[model samples]
Target chain A: MTTDVLIIGSGGAGLSAALSAKEQGADVIVACKSLPNNAQTCMAQGGINASFDINEIDTHISDTLRSSHGLGSEQMTRTMCENSAIAIEWLASIGVPFSLDEKDNLAKRFMGGASQKRTYYAQDYTGLKILHTLYDNCLKNGVIFKNERLLLNLIVQDKTVQGATFLDITTGEIEAIYAKSVVIATGGYSTVYHGFTTNGIGSTGDGIASIIRAGGVASDLEFVQFHPTALKKSSILVSEAARGEGGYLVNSEGERFVNELAPRDEVARAITREINNGKGVFLDLRHLRREKLTELLPQEMKLCRLHEGIDMATELIPIKPAAHYTMGGIEVNDSLETRDIKGCFAVGECSNAHVHGANRLGGNSLLEIIALGRMAGINASKFEPKTTAKNQEQLLKDKHFISGVYNFTNQINFYEKREFLGKILYHNAGVIRNEIGLKGVLAAVRQMQKEFTFMGISDKSKDNNTNLVEFIEFGNTLEVVEMLLVGALHRTESRGAHYREDFNSENETFRSHSMFWKEDGVLCASFEEAK
Target chain B: MIKIKRFDRKKEPNSVTMEYPITEGLNLLALFYKLKSTLDPSLSFTGVCRSGVCGSCSVMVNGKPTLACSYTPKSGDLIEPLDYHPVKRDLIVDKTKALHTLNQAQTWIHKTNNIPRDTQNLHRIERQSNCILCSSCFASCPVMAVNSDFLGPFALTRALRYTTDSLELQPLDTLTAIQQNGVWDCTLCGECTAVCPQGIDPKMDIMNMRSKSVQNGFDDPTLANMSFGFDFTQGF
Candidate 1:
C-alpha cells in the first residue's frame, strides 16, 4: 500500500499526525500492531500540561528544565510550551470532553513537578479521553486505518526514508508499503520490564529499533523513567492523579520522606532508597474524602481494589516504581525530523526532542506529543513523492532475519532468557545505577545476545502467531536495551533519571544528550551536543 | 489445572484445549503469561496494560465476558474467545465487524451551528466517555444473535454522548440513525452493564437515548408500526 503519509503507530502522536496530514489534503494511512486507541497513551491518567490562564509558559519551561536537570533544549521546550494552549484547543475542538470548571472553562490539575494547576484533564482518565477523541476525529475525517499490521522494516534508500515493510499479524504476509513520508510514532520501550512495567505489551521500541537499524540516530537512550506509584502486585499504574488528588506516600515508618508533588525521578529514587533500606513504600489515600477519590480517580480506585485488594478509603495501597516511560528514543531535530534519515520523522515517546532531556515532567509528555505530531504532519504533508527502491540485499537481509526467527530451532528458550533480561535490567539499570551494576547489566545482556542466536521459538504455526510476534518484539527490546546500557555506562554522571551511585555528582563535561547510533554495523554511544 | 481453548482455522480440530498447572494471580493475564512461557509456548493472547485500561485482553472466562488482565481467575476456569465474534486465534477475536458500528452510527459530534462562545458541564458526558471499547458488552449482548447489524452498546452510548453534548447541533440526526438495530433493538438484558469494566452503563445510555429518540420525532420501529404495547424484543 502507498500513501502520501504513512504513520507507523496509532497512539496520540500517530493519530494526531494522520488527522493533521489529512486536513492538509494528504492521503494518510495509520498502521498499528493492535487496534487503534489501545496504545500506551491511555495509560497516562494524570492529564496534559497546558497553561491557559493559570501559569506562564516560561515557568512551565523552567519546571521542565529543572525536571530534566538542565539537559532539556530550551528552544524545543519553548516551541512545545508556547503551542500548548493551541494543542489543548485542537484536542478540545476535536471533542475531547475536558472536565470544565463551574465558570465553564477547561478544568486543570497539578501533577508532580508542576508549579501550578496547569494540567488540563478529563477527570483522571485524561489520556484515554484525548486518545479516543483523536481517534473519533481521525475516523470522521476518513483517515485510513490498517490495524494488526506490525512494522518490520523502514524503506530507506538514497538517504531518504520513504515507507516500510509490515507483517500482517493475521495473514502472516510480509508486505512492503511505500509512502511519500513515514512517521514513526510507535511510543516507547518501557515494556523492556516485560511484566514489571506500566506500559502496554506493544511498547517495545519497535519504531526506534527500526529507525536505528535504518541508520537513524537514537538520543538519550539511557533515561528510562520509572513511575513511583504502580501497584506493587500487578504493576498496573496508579496514576499521579492519585497524588495530585491529595494522596501522599509513606514508608513502613509512616513518615513522608519526600514531597508527593516532587518530580517523578525524585519520588522514584526516594521510594527505591526506602525499599533498599528494607522499608515498605506505600501510597496512602486514607485521608482523602471517599466521594472525592471516587469522583476524581475512578481508575485508580478500581486498580487498587482489583489488583491489590486494597480500598483506598480504608487501607493504604502498596506501591513500587515500575518502568513507566522511556524519555529517550530516535533523535529528531527541531522540525521533529531525524537528523540522519530524511523524510523519516519521529514523534511522541518514540522520539527524543531533547525537550524532556534526562527526565520528563509528568504532564509534559502529552503536550510535547501533540506539538510534535502537528509539526511532523505539516512537514511530511508538504513533501514531494520521490521514488526510492530498497536494495535487494537489504530486503533479502530483512527476509532472512524474519524467517530465521521462525525456522531456527535450538535448546535456548527466549521466554526464560527474556525473564532473566527483565530482572537484571530492573535491578541494575533500574531507578538507581552504579558502575558495577551497569557493567553487570552489560555482561548479562551480552550473554543473552549470544544465546539469542540459538534461541528456540516453540510455536511453529504461522497463522495469527503472537508467539512469533512477541519473539520479534523481544529481539527489538534486546537491541534497544543494549543502547540504554551503553549510554548509561558512558554518561558517568548523576543527573535526572540516570542516577550514578559511583559518580554521584552531575558533571559539566557530560551535559549534552547521550546519542547512540550504528558505526559500520556496530552499536556506538557518545555525548553529542544538539545542532 | 488450567486449560486454554485455542482456535485456529488452519488446524484440524478447529479448536484445541491445552492444560498447564493452574497459576494464580491478581489477574489472569499474568497467569496466561506464566502458562505461555513455562508450559505451552504457543498459547496466543493479547495483553497490553494489565491494568484493564487498554481493553485489548478481553476474553470469556467460564462463559462470561471478562478482561483477562483485570478479572482474577481460578483453577479449572474455562477461558474462550468472545462469544459471538469469530475468533482469529486463541482468545483473540476479530473485532473488525464489532468495532465498525461506531463508524456506521456516525458517533462523532456533527455541529450544525457555529456556536462560538461556550459554557460546558463535563458531568453531562463524563460517564459515557469512560468506555474502553473492550467489546465485552458487544460479546455478551443477546441482541447480537438477532441483529448482527445492531449498532451494539458502545456505539449507541457514544451517540447518546453526542446527543447530550452542549456543543452538538444535530442530535436528532444521530438519534434517528440509532432508532433501528441501534437503540430500540437492544433487549435491555443489562448484560452490557454487567460486563463493562469501565463501569459505563451502556444499557442505561441506551435507555436514555430511547427517551431522547421519542422526545424528538423518532420512534421505536416496533412500536411505531404496532398500535400500542411494550415490545420486550424491541426494548422499552
Candidate 2:
C-alpha cells in the first residue's frame, strides 16, 4: 500500500494525526495491530489537562516541570500547555462530550501534579470520548484504516525512512507499504510489566522496537511511571480522579497515609513503601454518597463492582502501584520527528520529547498526545517525498531474517522466559531500584536473550496466528526490557521515576537525560546534559 | 470444566463445544486466553485492554451479548460470537457493518465553531454520548434481528445526543438523518438499554428523539394516525 502518510497505531495520537493529515489533503493510511480504539488512550480514565483560562498557562507549565523533576523540555511543555485550550476546543468541535459544570461551563477537576482545576472531562471516560471522537472524525475525513496489521519493521536506509513492512494478522501475509511520511503512535511499553499494568495488550513498545531495528536512537528509556492505585492483583486502573474528587487513601488501619492529591511519583512511592512495610493500601470512598459516586465516578464504581465485586459507595477498594506509563521512548525534536531517521516521526507515549521528564502527571498525557500529534501530522504532511526504493531491500531482508529465526524448532520455553522477565522487571526495575537489583535483572535478561534465540512457534499456520504475533511481541519486550535495565543501571542517580536506593536523592551532576543505542547488537547507554 | 462453543474452520467449518478446566475468577477473555495458550493455539477471539472500556471483547455468554472482559465464566457457559454480524472466527464477529451505521447516521456533532454557551441542560445528551460503540446493545437489539438496516441503539443514541446539543449547528439535520431506519424503526424493546456497559439508555433517548421529531412536525405516518384515533375517541 502507498499513501502520503502511513500512521502506525490508531490510538488518540494516530487518529488525531490522520485527521490532521487528511484535512491537509494528504492520503493517510492508519495501520493498527489490533482494533482501532484498543490503544492505551482509550483506557485513560482521568480528564485531559488544559489551561483554558489562559492566565494559568504558566502555572500549568510550572506544575508539569515540577512533576517532571527538571527533565521536561521547557519549550515542549510550553507548547503543550499553550496549545491545550485550543486542543480542548478542537476536541469539543469534533464532538467529544466534555463534562460541563452546573453553571454550563467546561467541567474542570483537580488531578495530581496540577496547581489548578483545569482537567476537562466527560464523566470518567475522557480518553474513550476523545479517542472515539478522533476516530469518527478520521473516518468522516476519509482517512483509510487498515486494522489487524502489525508493523514489523521500518524501511530505513542512509538516514532516511521510507515506509514499513506489516504482518497482516488475518491472512498472515508479509506486505510492504510505501509512504512519504510515517508516524509511530504505537503507545508505550508499560505492558512490559504484563500482568501488572493498566495498558492494553498491544502496549509492547513495538514502534520503539521497530525504530531501533532500523538503527534509530531512543532516550530516557530508564524512567517508567507507576500509577499509585491500580486495582489489587488485576492492575486495572482506579482513575486518579477518584482521589482528585476527594477520595482518600488509607492503610490497613484506616489511617490516611499520604496526601491523596500529591504528585503521582510521590503517591506511587508511598503506596509501594506501604506495601513493602506489609500494610496493605486501600482507596477509601465509602464516605461519598451513593448519588454523588454514581454521578461523578460511575465508571470507577462500575469497574470495582464488576471486577472486584466491591461497591465503592460502601467498601474500601484494595489498591497498589502498577506500571502505568513509559516516560521514555523514540527521541524526537520539537517537530516530533525522530532524531536519527528522516521522514519518520514519533508522538504520544511512544515518543519521548521529554515533556514528562522523569514522571508523568495524571492529565498531561492526553494533552501531549493531541498537541504533539497534531504538530507531527502538520509537519509530516508538508514534507517532500523521498526515495524509498533502497530501504525496501533492507527491510525485506530483515523481515526474512525474523521469520527464519522464529520458524526454527527449539526447546526454550518462550512463555516461561517471558513470565520470568516480567517478574524481574517488576521486582527490580519496578517502583524502587537499587544497583544490585538492577544488575541482577540485566544479567537475567541477558541469559533469557540467549534462550530466546532458540524460541520456536508451535502454530506455523499462516492465518491469524496470535501465537506468532505474541512471540514477536515477546521479542520486542525483551529488547525494551534490556534497554530499560541498561538505562536504569547507567543513570546511577535518583530523579523522578528513576528512584535509586543507593542514590536516594537527586544529584545536580546527574541532571541529564540517559540515551541508549545499539552497537554490534549489544545495548549501550550514555547521558546528555539537560538542555 | 468449562464448555466453549468454538468455530473449527479446518475440520468441520462449524461451531463445536469443547471442554477445558476452569480457573477461579477467570473472565471469558481470560478463559479464551488460557484455552488458546494451552489446549488449542488456533482458538481465535478479539480482546484488547481486558477491561470493559475498549469494547473489543464483546461476545455472547450463555445466549446474552456482553463484554467477555467483564463477564466471569460460569460452568457450561455457552460462548458464541455476537449475533447480527458475520463471524470472522471463533467468538469474533465483523464489527465493520455495525460501525458503518454510525457513519451513515452522521452521528457526530455538526461543527458550529461556536463555543457552547450554556451546557447545564447537556447532562442528558452527555449521558447519551457515553456510548462506547460496544455493539453489545446492537447485538441484543430485537429491532436489528428483523431489520438489519435499523440504525440500532448506539447510533440513535448518538443522534439523540447531537440533536439535544445546543452547541450543534444543525440539530434539525441530525434528527432528520435518523428518521428512516432510525428512531421510527426502533420498537423500544429496551434490550440495548439493558446490555449497555456504559449505562446509556438508548431506548429512552430514542423516545426523546421521537418526541423531538414530532415537535419538529416530522412525525412518522404510521404513528400519526394513532394520535388521530385518540383525538377521534376524545370527540366521541
Candidate 3:
C-alpha cells in the first residue's frame, strides 16, 4: 500500500507524528507491532515537562542543558523552550486535563533538573491520557493504523527512501508498505541490559535497526541513562516524581545516601556506589507525608503495601540503579531528518539528535517527543518522494552481500546468549565503568559474535520467523555494544552518566559527546565538543 | 488440592468447570482459554498484550481485582468481574466508559504555541502519558461505585497530567475542568491506587489536584456542604 508517511511505531512519537502528518494532508499509517497502547510509552509513570505559569521557559531550558552536560544544541533547546507552553495548551484543547494550582492555573511541580515548577500532569497516568486522546483523535480524523504488524526491514531505493516490509503476526504474512517518508519512533533499546527500567519485551529497537541497516548511522551508542531508583527485583521504575515530591534515597543501613535532590546521574551513581560497597540501596519515603505520598503515587505505594507488605508511605522501598534511557540512536540532524536519507526521519528515543546528550533530565524526555514528533512530522511533509528504481539494484546487491548472515548452517541459542550479553553489559558497561571492564566487554562481544555465527533458526521462511528476527536483533545489539565499549574507553573521564573509575577525574577533554560508529566491522569514536 | 470453578456469564449458562489441577505455571488467562476449548467455544473475554501492559483482562481473582494476563490462577480461587461494574459476560465488563470518561475529563494536556517542533519538551510528563487505559483504576475506585459522576481516580490523574506538563499554556481551563467533578470527587481512599497493575497513582493525582484547586479558590463544596450535600446519598 502506498502511504504519504509511514510511521514505524505506535509510541508517543509515531502516534504524534502520524497525527500531525495526517493533518498536513498526508495519508499516514501508524504501523504498530502491538496494540496502540501496548508500547513502552504507556508504562511511563512520570509526568511530561512543559513550561506552564509556575516557571519561565528559560528555567526548563537551562535545566535541560544542565542535565545534558553542555552537549544539547542551543537552537534546539531554545526552540523546545519557547514551544512547551503552547504544546500543553494544544493538548488541553484535545481534552488533556491539567491539575490546577490555587489560582486555577495548571499546577506545576518541580523535578530533577528544573529550577522551578513546570511539569504538568494528570494524576499519574499522563501517558495513557495522551495515547488514548491521540488514538481517538486519529480515529476521528481517519488516520489508518496497521496494528500488530512486526516491522522486519525497510526497502530503500538508492539514496532516497521508499517503504517497509513487515510480518503480520496474526496471519504470518509479509506485507509491503510503500511510503514517501518514514518516521522511526520505535523508542529506546534498554533491553540490552539484563534488568532494565524499560519494559523488556518492547526493547528490541526495531525501527533503529531497520534504519541503520538502510545505511543510516546510529551515533552516540554509549550514553545510557540509569534511573536512580527501580524496584529491586522487578526493576519497575519508581518515578523521579517520587523524589520530586520529597522521597529520599537511603542505604540498607537506613542512612541518607546522597543529596536527596541531586540530578538523576548523581543520585544513581551514589546508589550504585553504595551497592558496589555492599550496602544495598533503598528509597525511603518514611519521612514524607504518607497522605501526600499515597495521593501522588497511589499505585506505587499500593504495590509496596500489598505485594511487599510494606507501606512505602511509612517504610523504605528497596531499590537499585536500573538501566533506563538510551542517549544514542539513528543519527539525525536539526530537523530530525536522518543524515544521507532524504525522505527518512527519526523521533523520540530512536533518534540521536543529541538533545539529551550524556543524560536526560526526568521530565524532559516526554517533552522531547511532543516537540520533536511534531517538528519531524511537519518537516517531513515538505519532502518529495523519490523513485528508487536504481536504488533497488543497490538493495539487491546489499541483500546478496548479507545473505550469508541467514545462510550459515551453525546456530547459537540467541535467547541464552542475549541474557548473557545483557549480564555482561550491565556488569561491565553499566553505571560504573573502567578501561579494564570495557576491554573485557569487547572481548566478550567478540566471543559471542563468534558463537553467533553458528546460530541457526528453526524457521527458514522469509515471511515470519520470530526466532530469526530475534537473532538478527541480537546481532545488532552485539554490534552496538562494541561502540559502547569504544566510547567508554575513549572518554577517559568521569562526567554525567559515563563514569570511568580508572580515570576518575572530571576531565574537561571528556566533556564532549562521544560519537561512535562502525566501519568494516571496526569500532571508531570521535568527540563532538559540547556547545 | 482444592479446585475452583468459574463460569462465563456471556458464552453459556452454567458453563462452569474445575479450574484446578491447574499446571503450576497456569495464570488466569490460561484458565480462561482452557474453559474456551473445554467448556464452550462461544466463550468470549478481553485480552491483548498478554505481557501485562494492557489492562483489558482484569478480573476478580481470589476476591481481588487483578489483571488476568499477569495474575496466576490458584486453587479454590473465586474469579469474577470487577466489583462495581455489571458483568457483561463471565469475566468481561464494560470498559468503554472508563476510557471515554477519562477523555471527557480532558485527561491530557491541551497546547497552543507550545506545540514542540522537537520532542524534548513533550517529555515533561511523557512517562505518565503512557497509560494503557486498562480501567483497573475504575474497578479499584471506591467513589465510582456509589457516585458514577465522581470522575474517579484515573480520569482525575489524567486531568492532572496536563497541569504537570512543562509545555501546557492554558492551565486555568484544564484545572477548572479537573476541579469540577474530577479532583474533588476522589475520596483519597487509595483503592484505585492499590489496584493499579501499572503502579500509577490516580489517587495522588487527585490529592495534587485538590491542593492545586484549593490554591485556586476552588474549594470542595462537597466537603464544605457536609451538613447539606450528604443528604443526597444514603450509603455515605
Candidate 4:
C-alpha cells in the first residue's frame, strides 16, 4: 500500500516520527520487525536526559560533546539539547509519570559523566514507560502499524529511495510498501556480541546496513560502547543509575578499582581490566539504603534477583562489561535525511547524525530519538510525491529467498557460526582492542562469511519461519562485522569506546569519525573528518 | 525430556506432539535455543530481549502461561502454544489479533497541556503501566473461551491506567471504550495476575476500572443479563 511515509521500525524513533507525520496530515505506516513494545527501546533501563534549568541546555550540550570525545558536531548536539525540554514536556503530557524531586518538580538523577542531576526517570523502567506512552499517543493520533514485517531492501530509483520491500512473516508474502518518504529506525548492532550484550534478538543493524548498501554513509561503526555492569552470566544490563545512586565497583579482593561515576567507556575498560587480571568485578550495592535502593531502582533489583539469583540490594552483584550501544549508523544531514538519498531519513540508534561520537552519553539516546525522530518525520512528510514502482524481479526473487534457504544443501550450520562470531569479537575487540586481536577477528569473520554460503535452515515451513529470517539477519551481521573490524583496524588510537590496547591513548591525528559505505556492493571504510 | 506441541499451517499433518531430551541452560529460553539450533532445526519460538521485560517469549508450560526467558524449566515439562491465540508454529502464537484491543479501546492518555505538579499520582497506577503485553493473561483467562470480543487484561489495565491518569483530561475515550467489551466482561478470576511476571495485578486494575466506570455512568451489563449462579428455583 502507498503512504506519504513508511517507517521501517516501531521503536521510539519510528513511533515519534509517525506521531509527528500523522499530525502533519501525512499518511504514515510503521512496519514493525517485532511488536512496537518489543523493540529494543523497551529494554532501555536508564532514564532520558533533559535539562530543566534555564541555562543548563548549554551544560547538557557540553556534557554530550564531552561524552562524544571529539567527533560529535556542535550543531547536531545543539539540536538535541535545545529540544530536550520540549520532548520531556510532551512525554509528561502523555502521562510518562516522571519521578519528582523535593520541590515537586520533575526529578532528575545522576548518570556517569554528567555535571548535574539531569535524567528524568520513572522508577527504573524509564524507556519502557516512555516507549509505551509514545505508542499510546501514536495510536491516539491514528498511526498505522504493520507488525512482523522484516525489511529486506529499500526500493531506490535514480538515486532516490521511495519505498521498501518487506518480508511479511505471517504469510511468507513479500510485501512492497510504496511511500514518498521512509525512515529507518531499526536499532543498533550490539547483538553482534550475542550472548554478551544487552541488545534484543532483532537488534542486528539491518536498517543501517540497508542504508549503507543504498549508498548512504555510515559513521564511526568501530566505537561500540561497552556498558560497565551487566549480569555476568546473562548479560542483562544493570542501569548506570546504580553507580549514580552510590553503588561501588569492587574487585575480588574487595578493593575499589575506579570511580563508579566515570563515563561508560572508562568504567567498562576498568571492569574489563579487572576481569583480565584474574579477578572478578562486582557492583557493591550493599552500601546503599535498602528502602531507597528498592524504590529508585526496582528493575535492577528484580533483574539481579531473577538473572543472577541474588538480592542485589543486600549483596554484591557480579558483573562484566557487555557490548551495549553502537555509535555507528547512517550518516544524515541537519535535516536528519540521508546525505545521499532524498526522501530517506534515519533516527534513533540507526542514524549517526553526529549527536554521538565514539561513546554515547548515558541518557542522550532517549532524548536523541524525540529530537531527531520528530525532525525526520516532518522533513520526510514534506517530500514531494514520488514513485519507484516495486521492482517486480527483485520482489519475486526475495519472495523465493526463504524457500531457497530451505532448499540449500545442509552443510555448515550458521547458527553455531553466529555464536562463534560473537565470542571471538567480544574477546578480541570488545572493551579493549589492538592490531593483533583485530586482525585475528577479521580473518575469523571472513572465514565464517565464506562458510555461510552453504547456509541452510531445516525449518521448511513458510509461515513464521524464524530460522530463515535469522539466517538472513546473520548475513546482515557479517557484513557489518566486517565493516567494524576494518574500521577498527584502520584507527590507530585509543579514543573513547574504540580503545586500541596497542595505541593505548587518544591522538590528535585520529580525531575524526570513521566512515563506512559500499562501492559496487563491497564494503569500504576510512577515517575522515565528519562533514 | 520436554514435550512440545508443534503445528504449521502451511505444512501437512499440521499438528504433532514430540519429546526431546532437555538441553542445559540457565533458563527455559536458552534450552529452547539449544533445541532449535542443534538437535532439531525446525523448532520455532519467538524471543527478543531474552529478559522477562520484553514479553515476547511467553508460552504454556504444563498448562500454565510462563515467560520462557525468566522461568526455570524442569524435566518432563509439556510446552505448548499459548491457549487462546492461533498457533503459528511450535510455541509461537499470533498476538496481532489479541493486541487489536489497544486500538479499539483507545487505551491512551487524553493528554492536555496542563501537567501535574509532581509524580505522586503515579504510585496509584504504577502497576497498570507495568504490563508488557505478553498476552499471557488473555491466554489464561477463562472469558476468552466464551467471548473473543472481550477487551482482555492488558488492554483493560491500560484503559484504567489512562482513564484514571491525573494528567489526562475529562471525557476520556478509554472510559467509554471499556464499558462494553473492556472492563465489565473480565470474570476477575485473577489468573492474569497469577501469570504476570511484572507483578501487575490486572484483576485489581479491572476492578478499579469497574468502579471508575460506575463513576463514569457505565452500568454493569452482566447485572441486566442475570443468568449466573446456582439457580435454587429449579423444581426438584
Candidate 5:
C-alpha cells in the first residue's frame, strides 16, 4: 500500500499524527501490531498536562524542567507547554469527555511535579478517552487503519526512509508499504522488565530496533521511569491520580513515608527503599468515601478489585514501584524528525525530543503525543516525495534474511532466555543502578544474544504464528536491552531515573544525553552535551 | 486443570480440547501464555496489557464472555473464542465486523469551528464514554445473535454519548443515526450490562437513547402504531 504518510502505531501519537496529516491534504494510513485501542496510551490513567489558563505556561515549563533535572531541552519544553492549551482544545473539539469543574469548565487537577493544577482529566481513564476520541476522528477523516501488521524493517536508501516492510500477522505474509513519509510512534521499551512492567506485551521497542538495524541513532535510553504505585504481584498501575486526590502511600507501620505528590523518581525510590527495609508499602485510599472512590478513581479501583480481589475503599491495596515509562528513544529534533533518517519521524514515547529528559512529569506524555505528533505530521507532509522504488529490492532481501533465521539449529530455550534477560535487566537497570551491576548485565545480555541468534520457532506456519512474533519481539528486546545497559554503564552520575548508587549525585561532567549507535555490528555509546 | 478449546486452520477437524494444569493465581490469559510458551508453541490468542484496560483479550470462559486477562481460571474451565464472529485461529475471533458497527452508526462527534462553552454538567456524557470497546458486551449480547446488524452495546452507548453532548450541533442527526439496528433493536436483556468490565450500563444507555429519540420526534415503528384504546381480545 502507498500513502503520503505511514504511521507505525495506533496509539495517541500515531492517531493524532494521522489526523494532522489528513487535515494537511495528505493521504494517511496507520499500521498497528494489535487492535487500535490496545496501545500504551490506553493504559495511561492519569490526565494530560496543558496550561488552560495561558498565564501558567511559564510555571508548567519550569515544573517540567525541574522534574527532568535540567536535562530537558528548553525549546521542546516550551513548545509542549505553550501549545498545551491548543492541544486540549483540539481534543475537546473531537469530543473527548474531559471532566469539568463545578463551574463546567475543563477540570484541572494537581499532578506530582506540576506547580499549577493544569492537568486536564476525564476522571481516571483520561488517556483511553483521548485515544478513542482521536481514533474516532481518524475514521471520520477517512484514515485507513491496518491492524496486526508488525513492522519488520525500515526501507532506507542513502539517508532517507522511503517505506517499510511489515509481516502481516493475520496472513503471515511479508508485504511492503511505501510512503512519502514514515512516522514511528511504536511507544517505549519498559516491557524489558517483562513480568514487572505496566506496559503491554507489544512495547518491545520495535521501531527503535528496526531503525537501529537500518543504521539510525537513539539517545538517552538509560533513563527509565519507574511508576510508584503498581499493584504488587500483578504490576497493574494504580494511577498517580489516586495520590493527587488525597490518597496516601503508607508503610506497614501505618506511617506516611514520603510526600505522595513529589516527582515520580523520589516517590518510587521511597517505596523501593521501604520495601527493601522489610517494610511493606500500601496505597491507602480507605479514607476516601466509597462513592468518591467509585467516581474519581474507577479504573484504579476496578483493576485492583478485579486483579487482586482488594477493594480500595475497604482495604489497603499493596503497592510497589515497577518499570513504567521510557524517557529514552529515537533521537528527534523539535519537529520530531529523526536525526539520522531523513524521511522518518518519531513521536510519543518512542521519540526523545528531550522534553522529558531523565524523568517525565505525570501528564506530559499525552501532551507530548498530541502536540509533538501534530508537529511531526505537519512537517512530514511538507517533505517532497523521494524515489521509493529502489527500496523494494532491499526490503525483499531483508524479508528473506528475517524468515530464513527460523530454520537455524537452536540449542537454547527461547522462553527461558527471555525470562533470564528480563531478570538481568530489572535487577541491574531498574530503579537503582551501579557500574558493577550494569557490567554484569551487559555480559549476561551478550551471552543471551548468542543464543538468541540461533533460537528457533517451533511453529513455522505462516498464518498468525504468535511463536514467530514472539521470537522476533524477543530479539528486539535483547537489542534494546544491550543499548540500555551500555548507556547506563557509560553514564556514571546519578540523575533522575538513572540512579547509580556508586555515583551518588548528578555530576557536571555527565550532564548530557547518552547516545547509542551501531557500527560494524557492534553497539557504540557516547554522550552529547545539551545544545 | 483447565480445558481450552483450541483450533488451528491448518489442522484436521480444525478444533480440539486440551487440558493443562493451572496455577492458583493465574488468569486465563496467563495460562494461555504459559501453554503457548511451553506445551504448544502454536497456541494463539489475543492479549495486551494483561490488565483490564485494553479489551483485546475477550473470550468465552464456560460460555460466558469475559476478559481473559481479568478472569482467573478454574480447574475445569472451558475456554473458547467469542461468538458472532469468524474464528481466525484458536480463541481469536475476527472483531472487525463487530467494531465496524460503530462506524456504520456514525458514532463520532461532528466537526465544528465553535469553541465549546458549558463544559460542565457533562456527568452523564462522561459516564457513557467510559467504554473500552473490548467487545465482551457485544459478545454476550443476545440481540446480536438474532440480528447480525444490530448496533451492539458500545456503539449505541457511544451514540448516546454524542447525542447528549450539549455541544453536539447535529443532535437530531445523531438521534436518527441510531434509529435502525440501533436503540430499538436492543432487547435490553441486560446480558451486555452483566458482562461489561468497565461497569458501563449499555442497557441503561439504550433506554436513555430511546427516550432522547422520542424527544427528537423519532419513535419505534411498532410503538408508533399503538393507540390509547386497547382491544379486549386479539380477535376484535
Candidate 6:
C-alpha cells in the first residue's frame, strides 16, 4: 500500500515519530518486525528523565557532558537537555501516569550520571508504560500499525529515499511500500554481543544495514555502552537506581572496591576490573529503604527476593557488567536528517545524533530519543513533495538491488556470525582495547566479510523466507561490523566508553566522530571534528 | 511441612541440596513445574497462567506469602502452603474457602439488566480486567491471612467493577453489602496493591468502596476511625 511516510521499528522512537508525523498532517504508517510492545524499549525497567524541577537540566546536562568526555556535540547536547522537560510533559499529557512523591509532586531519584533527582517513572516498568501510552494514543488517532513486517530494504533512487520493501513475517509475502519519507528507528546492534542487558529478541540491525547499503555513512560505530550491573545468570537488568538508592558494589570478599558513587563508565570499568582481577562483585541492597523498594520496585524486587532468596533488606545481590547501549549509529544532523539522503530521517538509538557523544548518560538515552524523535518527525513532514514523475526505471533498479540481497548466495547465518562477532568485539574492543586486539578484530571481520560474499543462497525467491532474511541480515551485520572495527582501529585514544587498554590514556587526537562508508565493498573511514 | 530438595543443576560434587527462604530464582510454581517435568511426572501442584496474574499459585515460598508462578525459586527457600489456606498436597493449597467467602458476600454487583457498554471506549476497563484469578493479593493481605472471612481486597476490587460503574442500576445495594466485611478490613498498607504484578490498584478500589459506603451512610465505625487517623494502635 502507498503512504506519505513509512516508519520502521515500532519501539517508543518509531511510534513517537509516527505520532509527530501524523500531528503534522502526514499519513504515516508504522511497521514493525514484531508487535508494538515487543521491542526492548518495553522491557526497560528503570525510568527516563526529563529536566524537570526534580531533575534539573543543568545537572543532567553536566552529567551528560561528563559522560561524553568532550566528544559530544555541544548543539545536540544542548538541544536534548533543553527539550527533555517537554518530552516528559508530553508523556504526561498523553496519560502516562507517572509515580508521585508523598506531596503529590513528580517522583525523582538519583541514578547513574546525574547528581540530582530527575527521573520520572511509573513503578519500575517505565518503558512499558510510556510505550503502551504512545501506542494506545496512536491507535486512538488512527495511525495504521503493521506488525511482524520485517524491514528488508530501503528503496532509494537519485540520492533520495523512495520507500522500503518489507517481508511479512507471518505470511512470508514480500510487499513493496512506497512513501514520500521513511524514518528508521530500529534501535541498536547491542545483541551482536553474546551477553547483554537487551532481550534475546531485538538484535536485527535492519535499519542500519539497509541505510548503509543505501549509502548512508555510519559514524561513531565503535563506542558501545556497557551497563555496570545486571542479574548474575539472567540478562535482566538491575537498574542503576539500585545503587542510586544506596546499594553498594561489593567484591567477593564483601568489601566496597571502587568509589561507591562515580560515573557509570568508571563504575562499570571498575566492576570489569574487579571481575578480571578474580574479585567477583555483587550489589548489596540489604540496607536500602524497604518501603521505597516495595513501593517503587515491586516487580523487580519481588523477582529478586522471591527467587534469589536474598532479601534486598539484608543481602548482597550477585551482579556483573553487561552490554547496555550503543553510542554509535547512522550519522544524522541537528534535524535528524541523514547528511547525504533527503526525505530520509533517523531518530532514537538508531541515529548517532551526538547528544551522548562518546558515552551516553544513564537516563539520557530515553530523553534524547523522544526529543529527537519529535524533531525528525516534524522536519520530515515539512519537506515539499518531489515534483518529479514516478521513476519506474529507478524503482526497478532499487528493486534489483534488494533482489540481489535476497538472491545473493551469501548463506551466512547471522546467529553464528553474531556469536563470532560478539566474541571478537568483547575479547578485543571491549571496555579495554589495545592496538594488537584492534588489528586482530579488523583482520578477522574483513575475512568474514570476504567469505560472506561467496556464501550461496538456495532459495532466491522471496516469499516470507526467514532463511533468506537471516542470510541478508548476516551480510548487513558484517557490513556494520566492518565499520565498527574500522572506527575502533582508526581511533588512537581512550574517550568515554571507548577505552583502549594499550593506549590506556585518553588521547587528544580522538575528539570527534569517526564516519565510515563502503566503497566497492571495501570499508573506508574518515573523521569529523565534533561540531 | 513438605520435604523439598532442590538441585543446583551445575556440575559439582554437592549439586543436590536442601534450600530455605526460597533461594534465588526458585518460585514454588517454577520449581514444582520443573520437578514434575524433568524430575517426577506424578508430582503435582495446582497452577494456571504461570504469570502472577493467575492467583492459583499463591503459596509460601520459603515462608513469606507470594504467588508461586511469578516467584523464582532461590536456593535455601523453605517452601510451604500459605499460613491460613488448606494444604492439599505438596505445594497445592485449597482456595475454595477464600473464594467461597467472596461469592457468598455477593462480591459482584447483582445486575438487573446488562448496562450498555460504550462501544467507542471498549476495553477501557480491559487492562483492569487482565487480572488472572490468582489470590496473591489475598495471600498478601494481613487481614485475610488472619481473619479469612473478611471480604478481601481481591473480591472488593472485583466488586468495584460493578458498583462504581456509571451504568449500574443498584450501586448503593452492591456498595452496602461489600462495605460490611469488605472495604473496612483493608489496612491501606498497600501490600495487596504492591504484590500485584498486573499493576491492578486493588487499594484504590477498596478506597472507592469505602467512599461509596460513607456516601450511603453505611460506613463502619472502624473505617471512620481509621480514615481520621484515630488511635488504632490498640486492636478494635
Highest DockQ model number = 5
List, residue by residue over B1-236, the lDDT tens digit for candidate 3: 32433444333555564444454544566556554434432344555434465566787766667887666666677766676665544454655456556556654445544443223334444444555667777877777767876676666766676676555576666687766667776678898778887667777767777887888777777777578445665685
Score every model by TM-score: 0.94, 0.93, 0.72, 0.94, 0.94, 0.69
Just chain B of model 5: what TM-score? 0.91
User: Which residue pairs show collisions in model 5?
Assistant: A104-B120
Model 1 accuracy (lDDT, Cα): 0.84
- lDDT (Cα, 0-100) at A439 in candidate 3: 91
Q: Ten-residue segment with the worst summed lDDT in candidate 5 chain A?
A: A385-394
DockQ for all models, in order? 0.57, 0.52, 0.10, 0.60, 0.61, 0.06
Better of 3 and 6 by DockQ: 3
